[model samples]
Target: MSTQYEALKNADLYSTAFRVEPPTELGERKMTPRRPGFFITRSLSGATDAERAALKTATASQAEAPAANQAPDGSAPAPAAEPASTSRLLVPAQWGLVPHWVKSASDGKLRATKLVHVKSDNVGTSTAFRDAWLNNQRCIVPMQAFITDDYRSGGKPKPTRIARVDGLPMGVAGIWARWQDEDGSELLSYAIITINANAHGLMNRYQAPGSEKSMPAILNEGAYDAWLGSSAAKAKEFLRAYPAQKLLANPVEKGRKNPLGI
Candidate 1:
């Protein structure tokens, strides 16, 4: 399975100019999303200036005019010039998953109110996530890298960044949902999946001593195919970890938490 150690390699390292691509870094091994804590890129939001022009230019291929009585599929609404895919909205959410069952935003529990992540282990059983998982609501989270904890050194805190050895972008297994508020405002939400850690990496070095029980399950390009592909069995394979050696980890600075969640 994928661990935060591998995720950081995709990150911009203050230590050096080294970069990595997820596929080349992990070799041809099987991978999964992280189990617990994992990294996410939030600072980037909305469409870029160039993307707007591209959206307009490519509108013919991306958008489609919808029927009068039907709702536009959020992924690719009518007037195809605009991308019909939800990748734009999926890139950054409010940093949580809000199930459709919640009557109102306030009706959500603390867990759903501020959902940071969703474990693959609980995907099939979680009432909030099961529907999305069974449906084609799965997505891939793109990130340059990620951070993790290491508490094995007797209490001294150590933060680490994990990234791909190659410079290409990597995708983490994710699930997304579309929710409309009481006032008719609609928003998208998503959660990254996680798994367990491996030896000889940042996760092994930084995770709390004896408390190193979990890591994010990462899906590489190949595993990503099965995950996003049509086969339910193949998608299930994505729930496991890729190998460990493909990952490399290094120490990083722990920044203050984001107030609004990027």
Candidate 2:
């Protein structure tokens, strides 16, 4: 999943920016999202000078007037009942999907027990994800882009970057939880939600026909309400894939996985 900053950028919000170190791989290179327009060479361990400045501004803004979840679009919504926090939590890619019941890092073993990918086939079932699904643990993973696989049948490996066609960044579906280490330090983790491939989309290009080894669970603007709102029923409906044409895939400079940049 992309970072919150990436999602905001995709939504056309430029003033705010968040930074973090991304993982080395995402299942396959073809599953990678496109390179974001903006990137900083700084490491993810500490905030860069630019990130520190941005954090100061964001912190001040939040302190001045905390958001009330007015709308899922990050805007003030009309009068309604209390709003669920639209606040997003950004964590390291290494820690993905920490279970709520975990008492310690050892307890977090279940993190690996469950598949990182959330399958659409078992929407209401799937013990692996049923709890998170019920508790509305869903979230948007802000990402610059993702890597995808193009398994060359009887050939070599093929990869591609699946980016937003509208020239925007994206926020993919994610589930998160908190875990504590032996020293009592709290840590957060998240996992990207994925779906099966459709007719002939990017998933199909590399994935064999009728393959379930591809595609991320992308939410559309209209469905953002149900997703962020945590309306399990409606969110399930929105989990359906958007038209393949809605996404744009392109070939990127191939080499070792290093810092992300244009």
**RMSD (CA, angstroms), candidate 1:** 12.9
lDDT of 1 by residue, 1-262 (tens): 2233222333332111111111213221111221222222211234466435433433342233221111122222222121132112123343457776678866543445445466667876788888777765776665555566556566665655565555444466777666778797765666767766544343555565565345555555433333554444456666555445545566564463421112
Q: Tell me the TM-score of model 2.
A: 0.60
Global local distance difference test of model 1: 0.47
Candidate 2 ranges with C-alpha deviation above 4 Å = 1-95, 102-114, 152-154, 181-183, 208-210, 255-262
TM-score of each: 0.59, 0.60
Error of 2 at 6 (Å): 9.3
Score each candidate by Cα lDDT.
0.47, 0.47
Best by TM-score: 2
Model 2 lDDT vs. the true structure?
A: 0.47
Supply candidate 1's per-residue lDDT for 185. 71
Query: How high is the lDDT of residue 119 in model 2?
Result: 64
